[model samples]
Target: MFKVPPRPSTSRIPYAPLPNQGNDSGATPKASSPARSHRSSSGSCFETPVAAPSSSRRLSYAVNSGIKPSRPSSVSKGRSSIVAPAYSNLSSAKKPGEDPRPLKDKAYQADCIQNIYAFLESRGFDKPFDAGMLQLPSSKLFLKIFEFVMKQIDPRFKYGNKPEDDILDFVKGLHYPYNLSRSSLQQAGTPHTWPPLLAMLNWLVQTINFSDATSGPGTTAAQPAHLTPRRFEAGPLTNLTSETSPLDEEGCRAVFFEFMKESYNVFMNTEDETISDAKSQEMMQLFTTYFEEARQEVALDVENLKTELSRKEATLERMQDKSELKKLQEDKEILEKLLSDLIKETQRGEKDLQGYEEVLLDKQQELKKCAEITAGIQEDNALLCKRIQEQRFSKDDIEHMEEKLARRKAVLQMLKENRMHAGKEASKVEIQKVKIMEEIGQAAKKFNQRAAR
Candidate 1:
């Protein structure tokens, strides 16, 4: 999940990085391509062409070098322009004397260069020479030259009109010198043009070195051009005519050959750095990956530990629950034993209370009998007193007394009848009291009833 930008900084490489940090400073990236051992090799990363070389001049640059590179007055490729069909028609109205092919091609290259230059300028890109401290380096000069030459080949450059003076002005403004026209390059020998002239000389040396490798029309067994992806060529153009001005051919060739030598040195210095940078970036990513994996492992271990801890805790809780249950059972047994002892003591106490209640009941019956005997004695004493305290009576008193006695006898007979009726009511009340006493006795009876029986 770490993301690199559209174009990572030259100092760093995210994928397939160089060794020992981004020290690689070579303009051309190395070709790590495997040999195409088979045309139908399934492992090939790049597609196989149907034909190895279709035409003899498939990638040829055939133009004469006699004329100044034709330049349109003002190259405006895809610029803000209203296509005046009228003007095109008027220009087309020319009397069929001119070859518009070269014109169109020159115009296109100018436009392309202008666009590239404009784009580079707008983006704060220093021109080739200024980039290297106000003097164009050989590589930058070569790249520019390559771009210029490619314009003749790239069909897409044919979109504008510009003049050759415009190109000269562009060259003049360059911080480094390119040997074009001595007038354009030296500028009346103001002594300030030497630096650029020196830069042009540097390029010239490179051009000669490469030119030496190539045998021109005079030689046989010619060595092949150093054809790499970097060199702008479709294929070798042995028969191709050079369209560049003959005046400028030597300068261009000299510059090109000079760059080749410089390029050899530059590649030597920067290849190791680029490799080192790529390798360092790779290590950074690898370290990041290792750390992430370690974190995941740690997280997994933590989760496992937590799960194990929870299991142990659950077991502990179960043990605690069992212990509590055992304790509760023991308490329940103790309470049962205490309750049994208390119940036995309470039963004994209840038996003693019943015995006391029986004794009390017997005493109450004896007291009732004693009270009845005392009442009988008192009645007998009152009778004896009545007999002794009687007074003697005369015959008339005696007769009156006898008459009173007869009246008393009559009253006594009436009383005897009333007493008989009263005795029946008392007997009924006593029977009800005996029945209530029997109910009470039954209620009070317990094991004593069986014992008494």
Candidate 2:
């Protein structure tokens, strides 16, 4: 007898009620069939069984006999009658030996189920099955589903006598990212082993979707029409083809020569003395058609080449223009920077001119005072000249007059020296003023030039 492992006490396995079954509160349910009992036992071995209601005798009987209890009519039909047990709901706070690994969330499992169903429906699978069927401990239906999905990839592919080997081979060929051991593959339909299998199926579906999206008719149509070559239409031998032929003009000529050679050989070696005129005409016509097609093909090629060359030349010109435009832009930026600097220098020069104008005003005031003093000195000199001209003296008074004249000459010399020193200082000031004015003129000219530009 095969012994089954004990189920964990933390979880509960829910069973879907049969469609024909009815929930009658008053009536007592019959005992489960042997097959139902066996399935229930297996389910119990995999997950903890839910507690039956103590008040209901039918529920207690069903639990004792390994049969799922029916729910009241008030309960929702969409959900199973069995209440799923949770770790938090346990009466005991602690367990001595519990598996530390966490279980997959219900939401995740539901998502997987929905995706699997959607994939099957898109692949045109017509058979009806629910999530409950997938959760059952059976491999037959799941294997069939797996095979159906594999067939979508390759219709001709078939499972051989060794299905395990075939499955391994197919999975290996796909270069599946997840490692799939033989034991996992063997127990694929069981609840304990379904997660990896589900993952694998989902991956395969995604790959198929991706491949279809990448290589479908829509993708082909999205490509540029000019990129693909035009295919020649098939026609009879008498028709003059305008498109390219399989053989070139040289090949056609060779064939014609070969035909002529064979004809000559036949005429010389066989009973026939000369070739038939109709056959010769037919051969010539065929060769002529071939040559015409070859010529047209060559012409088409030349035209294509010319168009390509023109396009390339235009592209090259655009590229060169772009480079020149970039260079011009850089040059413009440099010129703009220089112009800014020149403007700043011009502003500074204007400021210096303002200060120089103030200094020039002071220098003009000093020149005015010096001119007044020179006018006073000129009056004094004029008086002295008049007095000297009017005076008449004897030989004894000549010495006294000479001594006074000497004193006047010394005063005149000192005055002359003062006038010369003042003139020299005025000249230096004028030179400085001229230099400043020149600089101001240059700055203004440069500013005007830049502004015009």
Quote each prediction's TM-score.
0.16, 0.26
Candidate 1 residues 1-453, lDDT tens each?
211112223332212212223333423232222112121233211211111212222111112111222443233334332121111111111011211122123333333334334333433443453322223324335345433422322323232232234334223222112235544342422334433333333232222222334323312132233321111211212232233322244533532432333232232223355654453344335444434554686688899999999999998898679778899799999999999999999999999999999999999999999999999999999999998778566699789888999999999999999999999999999999999999888877865777898
What is the number of residue pairs that collide in model 2?
Answer: 0
Query: Number of the top candidate by lDDT?
Result: 2
Deviation (Å) of 319 in candidate 2:
53
What RMSD does each model have against the real structure?
A: 49.5, 40.4
For each candidate, what is the lDDT? 0.40, 0.50
Tens-digit per-residue lDDT, 33-105, candidate 2: 1110011332221112112222212111211122222322221124332211111111111111222112244
